[model samples]
Target: MEKSVFEYSHYRSYLRMRLESAGRRGSKAQIATEMGVQATYVSQVLQENAHLSLEQAEAANVFLNHTSQESHFFLLLVQKDRAGTKSLRDYFQTQLDEILKTRMVLTERLGKSTQLDEKDRSWYYSSWIPSAIHIATTIPTLRTVGDLAKAMQLSSEKVMETLERLENIGLVRKEGLQFLPGEQQIRIGKDSHYILKHHTNWRLQAMQSLEHENLKELHYSAVVSLSAKDVDKIKDLLLESLKANVEIIKDSKEEELYCLTMDFFSLLKAQK
Candidate 1:
């Protein structure tokens, strides 16, 4: 797969990706034309002895069909590569980092809409508020900041701030004065550092929700001692249940949004 431009600190590496990127018909000749150099010169540049000048770097961005933010990032990559000293590279790195923090480039061709860098990921997973606001947009009645604040029991200022941050990372979108869910989807994996925090945020909210005397709210926790063979069996059943529920959830109406968290794990140490 062709990696995102922001994933590379070196413009040459990104150009190399552009050269060999699957399904995108490009060649050294075409790339050389874009960079205004001979095909041999394109080879030399990729080999690291030669480097792209600022203007040629812009040309490369054009050749690679970069978005505006991606073009900026590509230019910064070239600048960082041309830096003579560590301090200079570090300086450009800061610019690159800032861009990564705020921009979520859309790789429409790749069909991967969301690529959250570390900073933006941190901001999004920092609290439940941003996530809540993201989900609130999917509700028809909660389109405006005022409506979101009233529905979510948050301040308008807080809603706007979170909405801006979410929009920056492509988690939310605003059309006119109405907010809507962005095309992006956040997927937190088991090994992610944010997984604990992601779970904690909602679990805490789930705890607080217990105060509400509503039959719709559900909570369950159990620690069981079972035969070793049945342990895997129980886990398989839980996994099956989750998969079945997910299928049902997919076709359900978007009337309300909710988080469904499930945890099943060993409470005791292994019998080693």
Candidate 2:
């Protein structure tokens, strides 16, 4: 007669169901005290108008004495529900499905491996070299090493060496005097060290742009205080914007290669 925790998609729903089942023997105020939150807060959370913080969710799981899998599933549901964007929610849901499908511990599976190998990952997170090679393939006039060098503003020797590395990595194929991009898509995991390096390189480039008088370049910054919850929402919005920009680039018939970076971080720490 009772719904299993796995049957619920939203953490709030699961918590509400859980509380209802326990309410026959326990009072709402008692449960609220156990969760270290007010009874009205519990009511609001069950009504789907409020969310539980990470610590609160963890406390709830501990109080409920969930099994390892059930706890993992519940935490994932909380994350998905609290996610600031639909894409992130969908991604977490997909991960949940995979966990159910494989019947393995989520932490064990996630700890096993990265999405990319070392070499391709290195090329992916490198500076403009890989982008220059890929973009050059789209332009017929920029096939030769010298052409790529001139277009990328790098020395011919450096361009040739980079092309050779790209070719070795199977990202580009050599056809007589021209280099062609191979049928490969570049994907890097968010946790990769290469991503940090990549971001650092581009941020340096952005910083350098301030010294140049290029009318085509744009840079913007803002310093504003916001709640922790609002910060999460803004991050999701930024990610969606980035995805939209990628889609626009994909749809363009003739595209020029450009780097777009968005950054948001707290400049000051919260006072205790």
Candidate 3:
């Protein structure tokens, strides 16, 4: 099945935002004129051109100074646009969420200092199972259900059930009688690693977990922007932020750091 309408729109939206940011001044006219095409071509690419010609894609790379990561992401968008028969975006998005959830668990378990009573610890452990499967498989050679169960001390039955659920939700597959992840699955796995390593549950939950209001004194901050330039800046800023925050936790009362984590979101900025 081709990507869902939502995923298609999102990819297009991302492309459009990147293009617009790259061509900051008169972006529409600049791209159209450079490509020897009409402004509508730029519009069409975002709305209908999922698969881009090499020429068009190259034009984007040249115009955007895209990093290797951005270039690869562009290729993915192009492939999806061409395939038009499978909604690959949905599959990966689901997997990506699961990976982040696992990272969140680890952040709470390993990254923070908290005052979790026995009951809280049990609840935390139970909540982290699904995420554990997601993270465990990321450790190559331990990707299969049995492997994940053994590595994580989870029941095989439970791991298999999670894998089945992931499959039903379009995150995994049985390719040629062997399990395989679709393109999106691979991307999700790759993405989760970075988020888990750098972004902790304290940051992620702080973005959405209003109930943790008491922690506001930590004086944390957020950065948002549409420009890839800003994204780069935010990445650096976050690294500094997390580093400093971690240092503070190490020196503070251990209980205050308990069960804390962080979250990071990198999305195309909406056009002004």
- Candidate whose TM-score is highest: 1
TM-score of 2: 0.51
Task: Provide C-alpha RMSD values for all models, in order.
Answer: 15.7, 26.0, 22.9
Q: After superposition, how far is residue 197 of candidate 3 from its true place, in Å?
A: 29
For candidate 1, the C-alpha RMSD (Å) to the true structure equals 15.7
Q: Rank the candidates by TM-score, best first.
A: 1, 2, 3
For model 1, name the residue pairs that clash. Answer: none
For 1-272, candidate 1 gives per-residue lDDT tens digits of 34677678788887887786665565788978977789888889989998888988888766665545667888889999899999999999999988876553443421464567788889889989888888879888887878988888888778877886776677876553466788877878989999999999988988888787377768887777899899899889999999999999888877776778888777776853
Which 10 residues in a row give candidate 3 its minimum summed lDDT? Answer: 1-10
List residue ranges in candidate 1 displaced over 4 A: 1-113, 270-272
Q: For model 2, which pairs clash? A: none
Question: For each candidate, what TM-score against the reference?
Answer: 0.57, 0.51, 0.28
lDDT of 2 at 95: 78
**Best by the lDDT measure:** 1
What is candidate 3's TM-score against the reference?
Answer: 0.28
Of the candidates numbered 1 and 2, which has the greater lDDT value? 1
